[model samples]
Target: MTTDVIVVGGGHNGLTCAAYLAAAGLKVTVLERRIVVGGAAVTEEFHPGFRNSVASYTVSLLNPKVIRDLELPRHGLKVVERKMANFLPLDGDHFFVGEGRTQAETARFSQKDAERLPAYWDRLDAIADVLRELVIQTPPNLVEGGLKEAIPELIKSAVIGRKLSRLDLTAKRDLLALFSQSAGDWLDGWFESDPIKAAYGFDGVVGNYASPYTPGSAYVLLHHVFGEVNGKKGAWGHAVGGMGAISGAMAACCRERGVQIRTDTAVAEVLTEKGRATGVVTASGETLKARAVVSNLHPQLLFQKLVGPGVQPADFVERIARYRSGSATFRMNVALSDLPRFTVAPEPGDHMTGGIIIAPTMAYMERAYDDARVHGWSKAPIVEMLIPSTLDDSLAPAGRHVASLFCQHVAPELPGGRSWDDCRDEVADLMIATVEKHAPGFAASVLGRQVLSPLDLERTFGLVNGDIMHGRLSLDQLFSARPVLGAGDYRTPVKGLYQCGAGTHPGGGVTGAPGHNAAAEILRDVRRRRI
Candidate 1:
């Protein structure tokens, strides 16, 4: 079979790219290995009567342009913002940050921190605005090259420079520090209260397998805030039908544009001729030909596993090999018999609908990371619980609920030759026990549970070593240097083989910017007959 473009992996980004390509009048086909599409953003039934977003839970960072252009709302996508932002339970106290309540919340601990909250938001908002603009645009090649090859890159550099130039000196300083400093240090400079710092610091380690004090963590913290929910900047919300609803809507949009999606068809190899990607060989031994091939798989998996050896440059191969992957993430979905009653905030309120964090301070977060690095999993693990069923009733049985437990500080690969398969249940119990400490009856309320170890995450969703952001969001692996310096523009060294995954510029989350930016580049190449 033949098509204008063959998109490998029917993840949300691949679906988004296919939609755009088909809209441009190209015949596009998407191949997915799983029985269903959406990749890690899918919702599944983990228990007899409990269904929840399996991998990626919560909603934010989905590009509005993709939603608007694809008309996802018309395809039945609905996202509602959380009434509160975060609920942090202290030893005998609680802190909550919601609309019009952050000041009062901070004042409950420190009056000085309450007054400084506005300045912190103003500074963070300024830096986020700069990154928000950059996320949708392709990163320019910063490495020196031949003059003829350098002209377009230089132009792109100038465009990016102009955007950065908008920032004043103070804003520039703040931006640079975020890219270089630790989240703990950065928050210490702005706030005094432990609960306030811990609430904001949690973003620094969400998909990142690092401590809050780890360098470049401030950037990870910054990465999470650039997203908005329902047009509200930095506000996180729940998709009415779980996270899968977003991808389902995108798939619908793709189908409407004449894109063909084939599930359970895995690509065994990328068929390249004379350094140009021509097509792919399926796992079933059928060869599907195409003018261009787009990969939404992780860069390491695509280049090392699928793309044949000796096809990529030696330097490029080495870079892809050395490209860091993996997260300290251990995910779980619980079928709760009833709501968890917190010790500090027992009464039912809007906080129950938002993120309930178990990490109470920056010190607690650091200890969790340090413990996991050596022991494979944190003894007192950090966990963020979100009860989506509280906001969306369709996910569970009447009066019962489903909650996503995004636990952290587990080693990507265990030490002492221990396998995650052996200890998966034990660690899951530890996570549940940790929550029980904060909410007395949380353990007994769990009617059932589905656990995904770091290894399980890698095997199940193809998130290499469980790195949900595709690759680490470190300074060395971001922007022009992502995946590697030469391959940052979504165009691989092998012509016609492009990357539209989270490993590219803007990096991770449910955001379709990589796919959006990649389609523009691929279309440009098609217009020039480069593909």
Candidate 2:
């Protein structure tokens, strides 16, 4: 009935936070509304025989410190380093962007471009080194006069401020442009190859309705690029046994550390006494007490629903109301009898290890975005595909494979009156048909399929409007501006309560930086109290 901390939402970040707190010897309990422990990063059996990671398919951004600190592998977490990352099918043969042979294979398409690849990669490494500073540190508040006033509240605001002020003019300008300019424009400035540009550009719009040409897209690209797989920078890789394996490992680690986990237990409200959180009330009329409560829900869902009205500042409540989480996404899982053969180039085998990006050029990507803008759905949307079975034998029957397709331009809440139930099947067909163009027998090879739209995503995982990162990963909604301006730190408006989820600093992706940073902040406050 009582504990030192009650963590709401059994997502990976929540699990990580709980495990760390438990490691610190605090009594912790995690309450998950779903029957399963994994939140979005889950693996499920959509068909009787086929199971695949339903929401989050890859694992490149999870902080290594968490893994090392928790010794997750000791608790049944095994990360199979994806030997291959992505294979983009083009025309029929395809171009690849993952590990080993794909690099040289990509070079074969354009020798000059190939020769420049290392330099390009090296530069990204250097830039990522600078951007890496951001991964650990909280984003600098951009509020006007914010530099002065917000400083007093920051734990290391001065340190981050000095690092930021140290940026050379061109680097500063370029960094600003990278965060503000569309990924298409930014990549266009870097390369001439349509495939390379498209490959990188796809990341910029992964969770957004905006086109690759939209401003602030390059930031997404950069943020995504900071992640590594098997210790390789800017590379993407799959979890060994569907995404759920990672979550399961985290949960196991939490349990190993003596953290109590309660699945299917929903929090109806955060019970506060004189404006300080003391515990939570379950929807089932059971009250569990805790010294502090942490919510992984979106700020809107937190204050608006759980915190109750009048608990937050009116301005904060209004800002939470305005938080945008409309993601134009649709997810699909298919059981395939045979590997898809594409018309692009050297076929899909060698390149399939990497993600398959259907966008061939910035122009092509923009037109796809424009389709959603005008038609409310892409006539030819951008599709990113990964066959985890190609690397992980556990996802499908022997020789059988599962393909997880992430499609864009299908608006979460589409313009006009269209809902997902009516458009779900249609969206799945469009994605398959697109793949069919590249791989002639892709549709026929599919034995069964599971389609999830933004509505389904929101409904299933409590993801705000189905926006996976708690809310949109936009500049306005990121950093101190995240969820709400002037509240970027883990600390909420309510004293003693803190946030440690994707809604906090550094925004979304599998990165555990937010959880780590939040805990440090809380521990600091606790230490001060002891003093």
Candidate 3:
């Protein structure tokens, strides 16, 4: 059947694009290679009656426009807001973090930080206001289209002028420091406690290949802090039934709006006609035609594998060739008989809503990165643990909890030719051993565990080289330089095609801005065709 649009994946981004396009009365069809929808944002009953989201742990950055556009809340999606932000555990039972709706909980760590918290919020609010303005507008492109592009250039400049007016000189300096410094350096300047430093530092390296000590790692922390649920900063929540519930609801919205989805149908190739993307060919030798083809996969996967050679510009292909997104993050899911007992906080409730950062100090985290730089996996890896079953009962049998562990400091493509198949179990053991330092008897609680290295992640979720964020959120690779140095405006060189995934403008982590902007671009393109 001919369709108005054909999306090559059923991830949240693809479903998002399909839903919006279908909502606009355009017939859209999405093809997912997975058995279920939601590429990374998926939940599965891997352990028979125990459901857990194998990839993409939390949900705070999903754009609210998606919720309103797809009416997600009305369609069986309940975003359960966790009360606590996160908990950092040290060797001597000292745990410190930011929590509660007010400053008192923050004051428990540093009275001065408690007092400065409101000021920080106000500052971040002002910066966020600037970021929101930037997020909505198209990222500027220097050398696109003809001379008439001056009008868009002028409008973008005006937006910048207005944004600059919102910040004072001091605020500008503060914003720069917040985005440029290391999270450990910035937090250490404010808080004396190592646990407090590590708690905030964890955000810097969450989805990136860098360590907490990396020069621009603080920007990642800022990126996460910019997202809010109900206007509260740094608060992350989970959708009931696992992260997959989010994409499922989006797919349902698409279906109700006349969008068709086909699962387990992998696209073997992207059919191109005269340098424009036309549609795709499935692995089973079936072909579907469409006016506009949208790919939600990483640019590497799309251009390097699916889309054949000679259609893309030689230079563009080279940039994709050089793009670096290889990371050794292991997304490990386990069925636990019960919540693992923490040596420090024995009470189950203490660690229920939040994650436990295994790295106790800044030095320890740096050492983990050092280990990755030298030995492949960390001697003592940094692990973040979440018990999703504590909040959502549908995830597991009664009294049983499911744990999702995000571990890092292992290289995805090691130089020594050590494949993932040989390293996965050792990586899992390393993660459990690190967690065991804080959560005693953690090894025993696991009834069944599934470990995924970068190669495994690439096989499962199609994340390029297991880099979950699509590409590193490096300073050069972000903003206008994302994915490539000059293609951040969602417009690829190929006509009738645009990008709208984590690999685009705002980087990654469940944010729907890339998809939203992509749809808006296509709609604008359609309108221009009439003019």
How badly does each model clash, as a count of residue pairs?
Answer: 0, 21, 0
Residue 309 local lDDT, model 1 = 70
Worst lDDT run of 10 residues, candidate 3, spans 94-103
Top candidate, metric TM-score? 1
Q: What is the lDDT of residue 499 in candidate 3?
A: 77
Residue by residue across 1-531, what tens digits does model 2's lDDT show? 889889888888888888888888889999999999878888998876788999988888887777788787787766666566666666534566665554586676667667777766765566676767777666544343555555655646677666667666756767777768888888777767777777778888888878888888888888787887666676667787788988899898888899999998999989988778889999999999987888877777788889966677788878888888866788889999988877664354546665778877678778887888777678888888888888888888888889999888766677778887888898889999998888888899999999888889888988777787788878888877876776787777776677888888888877777777777766766667720
By the TM-score metric, which is better: model 1 or model 2? 1
The lDDT values for all models are 0.93, 0.79, 0.79
Q: Which digits, one per residue and each the tens of the lDDT, describe model 1 over residues 341-371?
A: 9999998889999999999998999999999
User: 1 or 3, which is superior by lDDT?
Assistant: 1
Show where candidate 2 strays beyond 4 Å: 99-116, 138-155, 162-170, 345-348
Q: What pairs collide in candidate 3?
A: none
Candidate 1 stretches with Cα past 4 Å from truth are 142-145
Ordered from best to worst lDDT, the candidate numbers read 1, 3, 2
